[model samples]
Target: MRRINGGGVIEETCPSWCAGDHQDDQATDLDDLAHSSTVTALQMRVNAAAPSPLLSAAILQSPYEDVTSERVTPRAPYVVFAPSDDDFTIELDADGLADVIAQIRQHADRLVQVRNQLMALRTGMKGTAAMSDGL
Candidate 1:
C-alpha cells in the first residue's frame, strides 16, 4: 500500500509476508499479483519506448557522487547512490553491518568536531584558530 500520511513520503509497502526475504519466503498469490503488475508495467514501457520509472531513479544526479563502501543502512540492506546516480543495493551480513555502523560513528564524530570548529570561527575565532586564514 502506498499512501502519504502527515509526512509526504511515497512509501511502497506490501504485506509483511510479501516483503519477506526472497530466500526465505515462498511464492504467494499476493507476490504473484505484485510481480505481474511490475512486469506488465515494464513491458508496456518497453513496447511503447517510454522512459521507465526504474531507469529514471537510476539516472545520474551528480558527476561526483561518492561511491563508498561505508554507508548507513535504514533497513537490513543498504541502498547506496553512486557518483553517477546509479543505485547499488547491497545485503550486508552481520560483520558487514557492524563495520558500516562503526564507520558511520567515526564519520559522525568527525562531523561534530568540524561543525564545532566552523561555529567557533564564525562566532569568534580569537584564541581558537592558530593560523590567520583559519581565523
Candidate 2:
C-alpha cells in the first residue's frame, strides 16, 4: 500500500484481521505513521451496571524499521487496548495479554461466587417472610 505522506510503497503485507490501511500520509511525526488494524469492540461492564462502555482492541505496527536507537527499535506488532472515550491506551504483547485474560477470568469467578451468595440470601429471606405471614 502507498504511504499517504509520500513515503513510497509499504513493503509489509496487512494482517488478516486488518480492515483497511490506517497510515496517515499527512502525519508530521513518525509516531503518527503507525499502522493499525480494525478494532474489535469488547463490551465490558462493571458490577452489571447499565450503559456498558466499549473497549477497543486492535493490533498495531510501528511505521519505521531497522533503526538503531537508544530510544526506539523495530518492534513486533502488538495489541492495543483503549476505552471508547479515548482517555488512555495500553499496549501489550502476547504474553502480557495472556496474563490479563487470566486476571479477568479470576475476577469473573469471584463475581459468580458473590452472585450465588446473594441469591441464597434472597431465597432465605423469602422463606422467612412467608412464615411470618402465617404468624
Candidate 3:
C-alpha cells in the first residue's frame, strides 16, 4: 500500500500485516520514500543530455580565445620580453646564453629533487631510481 507524505509516496505492506503486532513507523516510511525519490532523480539526471549542472558550464569554458600582441612578431630575433624594469633588452651574449641554459638545467634538476622528496614522503621512495650523473 502507498500513502502520501510531504508530497512523496511511501510504500508499506498491507496495514493488516502491520496491525496488532506492528504499527506504522513514520520515520522509516519517510526515509524509504526520500531514498526512492533521490535514486529516481539521480537516474533521470544521468540519462539527460546535461547530467550535472557543472557539465554544461565546463564545456562552454573550453576552446581558448586568441589574443593579439604588439611586440610578439612571428619572427623576433630573440624571445624578447622585459620581465622587470631593471632588465630590459637583455640580449644573449655567450656567457648570458650559457647562464640561461645552466639556469634552465638547474631548474629541471631542482624539480626532480622536489619530486623525489615528495615520493619519499608519500611512498617511502619505493623503487625510485637514482638520478644519472650525466645530463
Candidate 4:
C-alpha cells in the first residue's frame, strides 16, 4: 500500500487490528512513520485513592529496518500503553509485558489485602462507636 504522505509504497502487510496507515509521508524522521491499531481502554488505575482516568492500549509499529536504511536493527511491533490525555506512553515487548503482568498480579493481591484490613478497621471502629453511644 502507498503511504498517504508520499513516503512511498509500504511493503509490510498490515496487521489485522491496524487502523491503517496513519503515518505522514512528509515526516522527515523515521520515528514519525508509524502504524497503530485501534485503541482499547484498559481497566486499570494508577492511583487507588483517586478515580482512574482512561488508560489505553494499542499495537504500534514504526518503519522497519527493511523499509529504512537509517535503522540498525529491525523494528518490531510493540504494545503501547497511554493515558487518555496522552501525557505519557509506555512501549513494551513480549518479555516486558510478561513482567508487567506478573507485577500487576502481585500488586493486585496486595491491594486486596489492604482492602480487607481497611474493612476490618472500619468494623472495629463502628463497634467502638456503638459502645460509646450506649455508655
Candidate 5:
C-alpha cells in the first residue's frame, strides 16, 4: 500500500540511462543516501495513508460473492445505529471502534439507572422483614 504524497515529486533514482552526468565527483555516498532516503520517505507515507498489511490480506482473501456484482452502484445500508457503535459481522476499522464505544457508554448509563432502581426497591423491602416477623 502506497500513497502519493505532496508535490508528487518522487526523488527517486534519475534512471540508469542518465548516469553519465554523475561519472565524476565521486558522489557515490551522497547518491546512496539520497536514493535510500527517498525510498524510505515514500514507504512511510504509503504506510500512513493505506490500510495495514493484515487488513489488506483480509480484503484480498474475502469471498467473491460478498462483493456487489451488479453494474449499478451500491448504496450504504440505512444505518439504524451510529457507525461507531454498530457491531459489524466483519472486522471494523477505527471509526467503528469509536461508534462501538459510544454505544457501550449509552447502554452503561441505562444499566446504572436500572441498577439504582433495583437497589432502592431492595432497601424498601428490608423494612418488610420486621413486619413479617411480627406476623
Candidate 6:
C-alpha cells in the first residue's frame, strides 16, 4: 500500500477490455470497505501469484467448504488463543497483557488477605489448646 493524499492506495493492472481513462464509475459499492483499495488489490495479488503444485493438491484434498468460506478478520491490538495436537498458544497485544497482569496482581492481593485471616483464626484456636493442656 502506498500513501497518497494522506491515505493508503493500492494500484493494479486492468485487462484491456476493462480499461478506460475515467473508469472509476464501474465500481460497485461495498459497505465500510474501501473497494478500490482493499478488494481489488486482493484479487489482483491472487491472480498474479500462481499456486504451487503441492499447495493446489492440498487445497483439492481439503473440504470444498474450506475453499469458499473464511471468516477471520484480523486487526491490531487483538488476541489469538489457538490450540493444536501437541501445543497451545495464547497471544495477546501488549496493552492486553498489561491489563491481565494488573488483574492477576489485584486478585493475588485479595488472596493474601484471605490467607492471613485464616492464619489468625488458627492462632486463636491454638490458644484453646494451650489452656486445655494447662488445665
- lDDT by residue (1-135, candidate 2, tens digit) is 444354545445556765655544343433445567877776666786764546667887765634553323355677887756466877777887787778768988999999999999999999999999999
lDDT to native, each model:
0.38, 0.67, 0.35, 0.67, 0.36, 0.39
Provide TM-scores for the models. Answer: 0.34, 0.70, 0.27, 0.66, 0.33, 0.35
What TM-score does prediction 2 earn?
Answer: 0.70
Error of 3 at 7 (Å): 85
For model 3, how does the per-residue alpha-carbon lDDT over 1-135 read when each residue is reduced to its tens digit?
344355554444432211122234343334332111111112124554654321010001101112242323211222222223233434333455467568768987999999998977766434333333333
Q: Pick the winner on TM-score between candidates 1 and 4.
A: 4
Q: How do these models rank on lDDT, best leading?
A: 4, 2, 6, 1, 5, 3
Model 2: residue 133 alpha-carbon error in angstroms? 1.3
Candidates ranked, most accurate by TM-score first:
2, 4, 6, 1, 5, 3
Model 4, runs deviating above 4 Å: 1-13, 20-31, 43-55, 63-73, 83-86
State the weakest 10-residue window (summed lDDT) of model 4: 65-74
Lowest summed lDDT window (length 10), candidate 5? 34-43
Better by lDDT, candidate 3 or 2: 2
| lDDT by residue for model 5 (1-135), tens | 111233222233443222223233132322122110110011123545752221110111111122363312222221122222223234334465457568768987999999999999998798788788889
Q: Give one digit per residue, the lDDT tens place, for model 1 in 11-127.
A: 244443233332322332221222101111111256757654431111111111233524342222332222122344443445754665687689879999999999888767655
lDDT, residue 89, candidate 4: 79
Superposed by TM-score, candidate 1 places the C-alpha of residue 41 at a distance from the truth, in angstroms, of 26
Q: What is the lDDT of residue 32 in candidate 2?
A: 48
Question: Which pairs, if any, clash in model 5?
Answer: 84-99, 84-100, 85-99, 85-100
Instruction: Enumerate clash totals for all models, in the order shown.
Output: 1, 2, 0, 1, 4, 0
Best by TM-score: 2
